[model samples]
Target: MISGETTLDVRRRLPGVPAHVGIIMDGNGRWAAMRGLPRIEGHRRGLEALRGTVRAAIDFGLDYLTVYSFSMENWNRPIEEVADLMGLLKRFIRNDLGELHKSGVKVKVIGGRTDLKPDIRALLDEAEDLTRSNTRLTLIVAFNYGSRQEIAAAARALAEEVAAGRLKPSEINETLLSQRLDTAGVPDPDLIIRTSGEKRLSNFLMWQAAYSEFVFLPMHWPDFDRHAFETALAEFSARERRFGRVTAQGQNGKTKKI
Candidate 1:
């Protein structure tokens, strides 16, 4: 357990420890390829990394941890790989749900569900329902999620409301749109980390990441550990988040456009 003083010291040094953190778990296949092993091996090891990261998140006092588990684009992969991925998902939920709930971690899944198999959908719903009241941390799994599709769906819903004369077209705003998103009621991530040196968002949380701090790591997803997580948080702490306006230091010192 983290002592009070230790926690305070960490906070003092890493003041920017984000309340919500998002991760793009990339490089599984590449890692496996580099090792001359099947891609499934890398994915399997990545699952182990994820388990460790969840425990780390709870210890770090993070309120939300969002992971890009699967994407809408992932369906284009070989059918066998997809089946393996689905199997892993089922295995993780079946094996970890009870432990997660016991540790006060809530599981929240974001993404489209209409096309998912009934069993997969049921497992997701069961995870959420089982841990709805947990307060320690929320593990958001982005399965079959595409930022563009999410945005389009929200727009469609709002348009329907307008067509029904229940709302004005001009009444639409960022807040309204956000409420309709899969991540509705969740705080926007303050930091987004991508492994394997990837520097792009790749359609993950495109709209919600407008002001997020990004950390790209050269290590693959399977190698991500608590230390790596802390390193990213420390990097975030060292930077100033100005949002859109210049900081007071920036205003008084060398003026650089944001």
Candidate 2:
């Protein structure tokens, strides 16, 4: 749970805001371990954080938000934990899908769909379909996602297109590859925030976050709040994204894209 703070404090602390935000929800299990709670309880708390994040993003007027829900590597966790996670996920969708739809939040799930059970997969499909026409915000959930595997899958798809004469070998370009990625049609993340102060990408989105401004928050996932979000957004807004070249424009705070 986040510390006690008045609403006025959060409003006063709000600074630069971001339009597209990505979060690596980390430290749930560690938080539980520190509190002597069951690991699944940590996941539950993380879900609570998810609710907060979604509402905050809406309140902050963010256009896109992506969360690392279940990575492909997480399959190695204890079977009981994995099952419990799935159960929680199903319950979340069942309880919140209608509300999310009403809120006009578009939902999309990225990564391998084969690993999920039929019912869960169906639920995801339903969620995405139900929210396809929504325009309020885009919420991407990366489940069974791995950066390397996503890139490989994109490569394979491109190769197939070439073999089928749908695409010339010379037609393969960054744009084509982007369309092949699981995040096809989605814009690259502008701000990537990782909780628990982690600095690594951890196979989240190698291709998508090629140049995202990063924020490493010391707070755990369950501890993050609107204030933390505002802090990260402010820091990101203060940065000058040079991409790969020096800005030819005078080094004034004005953004001059390379």
- Using lDDT as the measure, the top candidate is 1
Q: What is the TM-score of each candidate against the true structure?
A: 0.92, 0.90
Each prediction's whole-model lDDT (CA): 0.93, 0.88
Off by over 4 Å in 2: 1-16, 248-258
Worst 10 residues of 2 by lDDT: 6-15
Q: What is the Å distance of residue 54 in model 1 from its true position?
A: 0.5
lDDT of 2 at 155: 94
- What is the lDDT for 198 in model 2? 81
What is the per-residue lDDT of model 2 for residues 1-258, given as tens digits with 9 covering 90 to 100? 248975534543565556678999999998899899999998999999898889888777777899999999999999999999999999999999998999889999998998678998999999999999998789999998999999999899999988999989998999989998888888899999999978999998888899999999998898888788878888898987777877666567674566
What's model 1's lDDT at 245?
79
Residues 118-155 of candidate 1: C-alpha lDDT, one tens digit per residue: 99999999999999999889999999999999999999
User: What local lDDT does model 1 show for residue 153?
Assistant: 95
Q: Give the runs in model 1 whose Cα sits over 4 Å from its true position.
A: 1-14, 249-258
